[model samples]
Target: MTYVDGFVLPVPEGKIDAYRQMAESAGKIWMEHGALQYKECVLEDAKPEMPEDAPETCKITPFGKLAGTKDGETVIFAFIVYKSREHRDEVNKKVMADPRMQEACDENNMPFDPSRMAYGGFKALVDL
Candidate 1:
């Protein structure tokens, strides 16, 4: 089964383009490093819900909910799929150590709060 990783973060209101550019660049890198797929989507809709990992709900809403609204808070979401957990680990190590990833450390260029970003890894239960 494939492994998956997800991320959610609040990007600054006016910096969507910058965030997109960065995400695109990094997404390509991730794919080159063995990710089966990489996707980044904007939060078009949202709802107040409590999830186990984030009990308070924060600002992220499920994709189903996000599909209906407009002008709501834009949360940047991304996912990377890997062939397996071991493959994910191997690719991740190289991705993390890549020069481009290190160059992404410029605090001034970031459009979101690094400390507040939510991220996690999951084992794929189903793909269909």
Candidate 2:
């Protein structure tokens, strides 16, 4: 089963192009480091749910709401897939050590708030 890292964050509308550029570079690095797949998606049409329609198990927060997006902000959903958890760890270590990764982080101003980004690792339960 593949292991995955997921991310959700808010990016300023005006910075979408910059964010895409950054993501492209970063995705390339991850792929080179052994990630099977890397994808970044911007929100197209996300809306908050009505009170009555909300799920009882937990808050039915949409991606926009989960990101706490502002008037001119949009949400981004990204993921990286690896062969396994160990492979993911190995790939991440190499990705983080790469000079290009450091250069990108140091030279470019990120388009989104790093503190507001949500991230997690997941073990695939089912794949079809």
Candidate 3:
């Protein structure tokens, strides 16, 4: 099964371009280090509708809400794919050791709030 690193966060509208430039650079590094795929997506539709008949307890939280976006911010969902967990570890190790990656990872200077970002490694349950 494939392994993936998933991320969701809020980026201010004004910084989207800067964030994208950074992501593009980082994506290239990950790809060069053997990541199978890398993607970054921005939120478009802000409103999520729940069916009238749906139970209150059955409601789901939208990405924007979960990301805690403020008035001038939007949500970003990003992921990187790898062949397997061990493969992911190997690729990530190489990526981290890369000089360009180190330069790109100055967290204090990130375009978005690092404290608000959500990240996790996922084991694939279904893929087609």
Candidate 4:
């Protein structure tokens, strides 16, 4: 089964470019280390249009809310795909060991608050 590392983080609105640049670098590294796919997307429409007749109870949490974005912040949703859990671990190990990744982790150079980021590893349930 395919495995995925998914993460959502809030980036300050003014720092979007910095975040993009960082994500681009990380994506390249992940792909070079055998990630099947790497994607980083910013939130566009938080209030998505729903069926006119849909119940209010069916409303889903918006990305901004899910990511706990603040007034000056927005959300970034990213994922890296691999062949399996074992493959993901292998790729991540290589990625983390890379000098570029090490530098990004040092000195809290990230464009967003690391403590507020949400992350998880998921096993494929449905692939179509």
Tell me the spans in candidate 3 whose CA falls farther than 4 Å from its real position: 50-58
Off by over 4 Å in 2: 48-59
RMSD (Å) per prediction: 6.9, 2.7, 1.6, 1.1
**lDDT per residue (tens digit) for residues 3-115 in model 2:** 99999999999999999999999999999999999999999868755678567875666888778999999999999999999999999999999998988777457788888
User: Which model scores highest in TM-score?
Assistant: 4
What would the per-residue lDDT of candidate 4 be over residues 6-119, giving only the tens digit for each residue? 999999999999999988998999999999999999989978877989999887889898888889999999999999999999999999999999988764688888889999
Question: What lDDT is reached at residue 114 by model 2?
Answer: 85
Each candidate structure's TM-score, on Cα atoms with residue i matched to residue i, is 0.77, 0.88, 0.91, 0.95
lDDT of each: 0.78, 0.91, 0.94, 0.91
Could you tell me how far off, in angstroms, the CA of residue 85 lies in candidate 4 after the best superposition?
0.2
**Consecutive 10-residue window with the lowest summed lDDT within model 3:** 101-110
Give the top-scoring candidate (lDDT): 3
Cα lDDT tens digits, model 3, 36-56, are 999999998788888899898
Error of 4 at 113 (Å): 0.6
- In candidate 4 the C-alpha lDDT for residue 48 amounts to 89
